[model samples]
Target chain A: MLYIALKMLMADRAKYTGLLLGIAFTAFLVTFAAAYFSGFMTRGFALIAENGAADVWVMDAAVESVEQTINMPDSALDRIRGVEGVRYAVPLALGTVDARFPNGRFQTFQVIGVDDATLAGAPVLKDGGVPTVLRAPDAAIIDDGGTSGKLLTPVLKTDQWPHDGAHLEAAIRELAVGDELLANDQRIKVVGRSETLPRFPPRPLIYTTFANAARILPQERHLLTFVLATAEPGLSPNDLAQRIHARTGLRARASEDFKTDTVRWYLVNSEDVGDMAAMLILAMSVGFGVTGVLLYIFTYENLKQYAVLNAMGATPRVLLSMIFAQTGICALTGTGLGLGACVLVGEITAKAGYPFRMMWFTPLLGTVGVLIVSLTAAAISARPVLKLQPAVVFAGR
Target chain B: MSTDANHEIAVRCQGVTKTYGTGVAQVAALRGIDLDVRQGELLMLVGPSGCGKTTLISIIAAILDKDGGQCKVLGHDLEQMSQNDRVRFRGKSIGFVFQVFNLLPSLTALENVAIPLLLNGVPRGRAEERVRSALDSVGLGERMNAYPAQLSGGQQQRVAIARALVHNPKLIVCDEPTSNLDHKTGQDMMDILRGVAQSPDRALIIVTHDPRILGFADRIAYMDDGRITDIIAGKHRGQLQ
Candidate 1:
């Protein structure tokens, strides 16, 4: 039976080849695009999440997401720290700041100011440790991912060229590493250039002390946007969030909630990213539709052979099983080949710095889509087998 | 119903009726026809178009349901059995040959012939072994891998015959088997069918209008307008001469 089914596939190799290509192309594109989008969102929110922080983000009630500014009193941290099951509550400032290199290269960077001596949000900077630069009042750390608002690659040391192009804070990049920046009229030096792991295109973040951010924008700078606190043994994040919300009129989220919120906020508001993801889904859907049609037509064209089998004393069930077997093979092959091609193409594109990423299970989802389309096609063609009049073989008379 | 008939009777049908559609639109394709194939006898069902010859052959093979009748093939009541059982019964007890060869285009000659045996749960190795001997018997040993489109009409019919014989079924039913063949090729096909009737354990039923095959059958059953008219002994035609 396997031989016969495979023979059928081989006999129509040209046609099946077309079908497989369609399935493969869709699987490749959709999986690769979806992975890149998800990866980007994950990387963006990972730093805050890695801190493993306070359950409640004490902010002005109007702030919708983490990135939004909502200054609370400095005393709120002391109060939250004293709550039950709260291991520790520390002040955290989340705001975008401008950083400059001497070469007129400026970029916007997320200014994550932590009261802890170590810079919490710099994310494993490679060139220099965030701990040393962030602890000093006059010295600060800059994210290589943080986009320098300027594009000068000439002046910085041979290795200090800005790799991250996305600028979030406009104030950071124009200042030279050794030069003084008047943040709120107080001079602060960019002592070192540091980069987080996998900093492809830098976000150009400036890691500073909370007091230093206050000097840059006194009105915008206040108590940290949210504090990080770990739970004691047997304490739950939900319960802790409730406690913080009750006392501060602020919303608290589990560690997962912050990550989810960041992704949700980006998806809902970022038109570019949303459009990209939507386009991929659309392409994936087309792949599904194409595969479905190709598979259905192949099944339909092969219907006569099946009917002939029926006339030759094959049971309808046997014929149905054969058809299904053929469909299953087609779906798996197409999806399998598609995933392989996606990885290959994605690797090539990623090496070229094209932002191509393939998730481990995105191809599985692609396969699921292929199967859905395939089964639908199979179901449609299968109807004829049920309705097939075995008497039709003798119809030519 | 047949205590007197020998156990070797390969097909027996009693009072079978088949109709198409319902009410005023219905046409009775067969009207209460009785059929029987004894032991290894080669029977020809001869009738004009629409005479229910094909329908009768199909019902006997369990390919079509008899509207009213008890049809037995190899001692199993086809009408009484469930659809699945009938399928197993057909795969096990019967082989079918049709006009136009009806070979699955996607499969080679060897693969097509081995299908029934495969569906019967015969392992691929065993099926290929049987198919090899069957095709060799039909003189198609050199063309086993040739697809249906590559074979001539007579050769295709020969492959169909091999497919039927590969499983060593108790009964073989050929629906207008020679209608698509030329005079000489039809004679060649009848000769091929004759070689496979090697034992009394198997029987062949040929539904054909070709008078050239008249000499190959032990008896020829005649029908018109969906009713059997007569059965002539084709074997003793020389005696008539």
Candidate 2:
């Protein structure tokens, strides 16, 4: 009976194709939006992930995330270094400064200052390992994707640069080594280039010694933004963070915990998070709406065949099984196609430097959503079939 | 079982009444039908449109519920049995043929014929073998793999008959079995149905309006307004017309 049901479903070519397409489109929307959202979250926490050597980060008590920087007294770094479980502690300074290119193109770049002696928090250099160039006078290292490529392009009257991630990447890549730029009237030279993870709204990223950073900006009594720390042998990062928090009277977070905190902060504070969530919900609605209507019409059109089966002494269970089998075929096939489309789109956007991360759970989430759509459609469509009288086969020819 | 009063009767209906709707819209399909179809006989119920031939057969086939009646099929009281039990009884004991040859268009003739046996829980291999033999008996062996759309009307009707006989049910009911076919095709269909559907313990009932195939019936029951007005011997061989 199931075999016959399948054959009957396959016989109507137009309806079958329409149903499959509807299901596939729904699956595609769900998976694509989820992957995009995952990509956004990964970018949101890039600062924590990029500083691989740091096991703990000590910040001001009021600071919730890396994006929300709160300056701490420079004395906090030394206090954290004296904690029992700490192996070593280094100062990290994060501040944005205005840079004017030699071509008079003015832009703002994120300046990260590492420990002057150890270069402990510096981005890994592209070719020159561990960047000794920062020791030079008035020297700074720029990201390979950061400067002298498209970032230095003068802002056009008509706004030639489209405000998107790809355009931002092109802007970052405009700067190069051996170029001198100005930060707040202080002359600085790009001495090296390095590769690093991209953050959201790609900025011109500059790395320099803490001393040079201090000299370029106005002097202040409290200069440290965060203190990056490592755990001693046999001590977990969480334990080291707790010790630092206790000793220094500052908020200390394990690196992993800091990443979670950053993501949570963005969720609560950013409109982008809400926008991505809305897109995901809309995808799910489209999936259910399109697939449900198509499946219902297909089943309704084939009611007569079902009636024949009913009259032939098929129980409700048998008929239900047949409908379920049809749903399974459409649901599984649609999910596979949708996921495949997501992977294809993920590749294309990634090449264009767009943020899109398809995790295992995203596809799993998509499959569940598609299954719900198919089953709900089947339940709605099966009502008429369950009530069909076999005697309908005896009606007008 | 041998001493039961309806032992030799394939179907027995007494005071069976079926109404389509209620109140002002009420249409009584069967006023009070009393019918008995005996074993080893092909009974033809002949009537015009709206005369309740199809309704009476539907009640006998256990596919429709009568408003009030005592309807027994092969000693099983249809109204007394639960819906599930009645469906089970119908699956294992009865077969049906329709004038339009209600073959599933998606299936080949062989698969269509195998449906009844499969519904009765026969394994696929054995059911298919029986289906093949039944089609062969109806002289449709060469066209077993052909879909109904690809076959002629006469050939399609033969496949329907083959399906009816494949499960070896005790009774087979056909409605308007020859109404869609031309004279020669209709005659050919009747020949196949009458030749393959008669046995000592099995019975066949056909409800139709065509008189050209009357010669194939063992007895013809003429109906008018849901009542059996006359029953006469058919023009079957060695029987009075």
Candidate 3:
């Protein structure tokens, strides 16, 4: 009987194909949306991820996330270092500075300042150079993320501009170790390129010594954005953070807790989250909507066959089982194809620098969602079949 | 199948009554139908349109419930059986052939013929073996793999008949079995149905309006306005004409 049910469903080629594609499309869209969301959330805490050596981050009491920071006075760092369980503390500064590229084009770059002596929180350079390379005079390390886009510099010198009314067609290339830029009218050399995790709303990144950053940027009264600290051996980071918060009277979070806080802040404040949610809801509506209508039509068209079977002594339970079998087959096949397509697309997009991550839960959620759609379709298709009177087979006579 | 010297009653209906719809739209389809079908007999219920022939057969097949009456098919009281019990009983004891052939268009003739046996919990391999023999009996063995749309009207009706007989149920009910076929094809269908009724433990009930196939029945019950009008032997076809 189940075999017959399958045959009946597959006999109508158009409806069968429509149903498969509808479910597969739904699965694909749902999974892609979820993976994109996961990728964005990961990027939301990317800075915290790159600064892996920091056990705890102490900030102003009103600062909630790393992205939105309130600079503490220089004295805050001293107070944090003086707290119990704090092995040592370093000042980390974050601010934006407009840099003039070689082509005379200006772009704003996110500048991160690490401690001058220990060079804590510096990203690993791509060329295998140590962080001590930043110790060079007026030196900065440009992150690889911005090298190909915003920081791309023309090979031609500024004086070599084609002034004869001819197209210059400047041969531009990524900024590298020997390139130079101007920030606040001060000359800075790019010492190396570091491979840091990409950031949300991707921006060019510049890393320099703390003292060099103060000299290159405009003067300010409160220059310290955060105090990065490490815990002593055998002492937990959470305990150190608690001690720092108590003594400094500021917000202190373990590294992992800070990452969570940053992600939570984005979830609450970012419009991008709402856009992703709307896309997910739209996918579900379209996927379930098309599949449900097609399935209902298929069942309605076969009502005569069901009546015949019913008259031939098929119980309601048997008939219901047949509908479920049909729905289950569609769900499994469609979801498998959808998830496979998602992984393939995710691979391509990730290479193209798109925010897409396929976590283990992404496919699981897709399968579960498709199963729900299939079950709803089955329930709706089963109603007319269950209520069908076998006598209907004799009606037209 | 051997004949029994003492004839056994296959279906007995007493004061069976049924109604359809409600309020101003209420209509009576069966008014106290009292009829009996004997084992090894082919009984045809002949009636005009809107008469109770279909309603009576539906009740006997256990597909429809009667508003009032005592009805027993194959010695079991239908009113006494629970819904599940009735379904199981119908699956085990009754078979049906419908007008327009009602064969599932997607299934091959052999698979369609195997439905009743499958419904009775017969394993597929065992059921297919019996289905082959049943199709062979209907002279449709060569067309077993053909879908209904691929076969002629006569062939499709033969497949429906084979389906009706595949499980070897005690009672077989057919509604308008020959109405959709031409003269020669209709006669052929009647011949296949007559052969199935020869089994001594089984009885056949056919609800039809076609008078051309009147000679094939052992008895014909005439119905008018939801009431049984007359019962005449099939040999007295001249009287009906």
Candidate 4:
């Protein structure tokens, strides 16, 4: 009888295809929205993700997220290093500077300054250069995102000279080990290129030493952006963070907790979440509207056949099973197709540097949503079937 | 077509009454009806349109409830059984043929014939074997794989009959089985139905208005205005009324 039910559903190819498309569209929209949100959240904390060696990050009490930092005083690092469970603490400076490329193009680059001796927060370089490369005069490492993107310079020296008005099209090349840029009228050299995770809002990165950053940036009373610390062997990062906060009256968080805080801050402040939620709601509405109405029509049209089955000894339970079986098939197949499509699109968008990630939970969420749509459709359609009078089969007589 | 005194009664109805709708729209369809159907017999109920033949048969088949009546089918009182029990009893003991044939268009003749057996919890392989034999008995063995639309009107009717008999139910009820056919096809259908009634433990009740198939009945009951006006033996068919 379940086999027969499938046959009956497939007999009307138009309606069957309509139902599948409706469910598939819903799954696709829901999954795409979730994946987009996940991608944005991952990128929101990309800096913390790349600096994996740090167990805790200490900042001013007013700081909320890594992106919105309030620079701490230089004495904060010494205060944190003096705590009982702290192994060591290093100073980290974060600031944005106007960098003039060899092609006479100017762009704002995010500058990260690590400790001069340890270079604890330095990103891994593509050529495996030692961190001692930053010790050279006016040396810096350009991140891969910058070399391939905003830092592209003309290959010809003639094109490197500044023009008066509009920019000219020329053959260009990525910044290499010897490429030079000017920061605040000071000449800086790119000693290496590092591969780091792409950031939200997609700013290019420049890594240099703490002493070099002080020279490149304007003098200020508080230039230390954060204090990176490691915990002792026996102490957990959370416990160390709590101790640092208690002793210094500064904001301190475990590395993982800081990442989560960064993501939560963006979710609360940005409009992206509301937009994604609206898209999800619209997808669910379309799913319910189209699938529900079509299923109801399909059942209503076949009421006579159901009546014959009823008269032939099919109990109401049997009839309900057949209906659910039909809807379940639609739900499973539609969810598979939709999830497959989302993964394919994710691969493409990831290559193009768009924020799109298909996490495991995203697909699971889509499957649950599609199942609800199918169950609602089955319930709405089964009402008329259960209420049909078998004697109606003999009505024309 | 004859019934012996020892043959068990398949259906017993007394003072069966049924009404449709309520309030100002109320209309009585069956009023104070008494009838008995015995095994090894073919009974025909003839009547005008809206004369309650369908209503009474619906009550006897346990698909509809009677307003006030004592209706017993296959030795079980239908009014006293729970809905699930009544449905199970009807599935195991009764078969039905509708006026429109009511064949699911998507299924092949073989699958259509296997429905009753499947509903009775028969395994697929065994049900297919029984369905093949049933279709063969109805002279549709060659066209068992054809869909309903692919078969002609007479062929579809034969498939419906095979479906009715596939589960080997003790009682078969048909409503206007031959009215949609030509005279030759109608007579052929009657011949097939008469052959089915030859079993000593099986009974058939047909409600129809066609006069050409009257000779196939063992007894005919004439109904009009929601009541049975007269009944006569098949040998005295000319004395209807």
Better of 3 and 4 by DockQ: 4
Q: What DockQ was computed for model 1?
A: 0.45
lDDT (C-alpha) at residue B6 in model 2: 35
lDDT of each residue in A1-397, candidate 4, tens digit only:
8998899889878888887787777788778878887887888788888788889999999887878886887888889999999998999998888888876778788889999999878877888877679989899998844234677877877777556542447778888888898888778899998878877767788899998888777667778999989999999999999999999999999999999998888877767656766776776677657666766777778888888888888899999998899889888887788888888988898888777888889998888987887788789889999988778878563
Clashes of each: 32, 12, 0, 0
Query: Per-prediction TM-score of chain B?
Result: 0.93, 0.93, 0.93, 0.94
Model 4 ranges off by over 4 Å: A9-22, A97-108, A124-133, A136-195, A215-220, A233-236, A246-249, A284-302, A395-397, B1-8, B235-241
lDDT of each: 0.72, 0.82, 0.85, 0.84
Query: Which structure is stronger by DockQ: 1 or 4?
Result: 4
Give me the runs in candidate 2 sitting further than 4 Å from their true place: A12-18, A103-105, A126-130, A144-150, A153-173, A215-221, A246-249, B1-7, B236-241
* Residue A21 CA displacement from its true place in model 1, Å: 2.2
Ranking by TM-score: 2, 3, 4, 1
| Per-residue lDDT of model 3, residues A1-397, tens digit only | 8999999989978888878887788788788878988888788788888888889999999988877887899999888888878888899998888987766677888889999999998877998888898999999998844235676777766522245432235677778888888998888899999888888867888899998888777778887998999999988999989888887789999999999998898878778777777877887778768767766777788888888888788888999998889888888888888888999999998888777989889888888988887888889889999988788888563
- lDDT per residue for candidate 1 within A114-209, as digits (tens), equals 675545444444554446665666766655452433323343343243355533333333344565444444555777665553222335566677
Question: lDDT per residue, candidate 2, B1-241, as tens digits?
Answer: 0112333788888888888878999988888888777887788999888889888888898888889978888998887898888777777788888877889998999999988888889999999899989999999999999999999998999999999889899999999888899999898888887778878788888998898888898778888887888877676624311
- Which consecutive 10 residues in model 3 chain B have the weakest lDDT in total? B1-10
Error of 3 at A194 (Å): 3.9
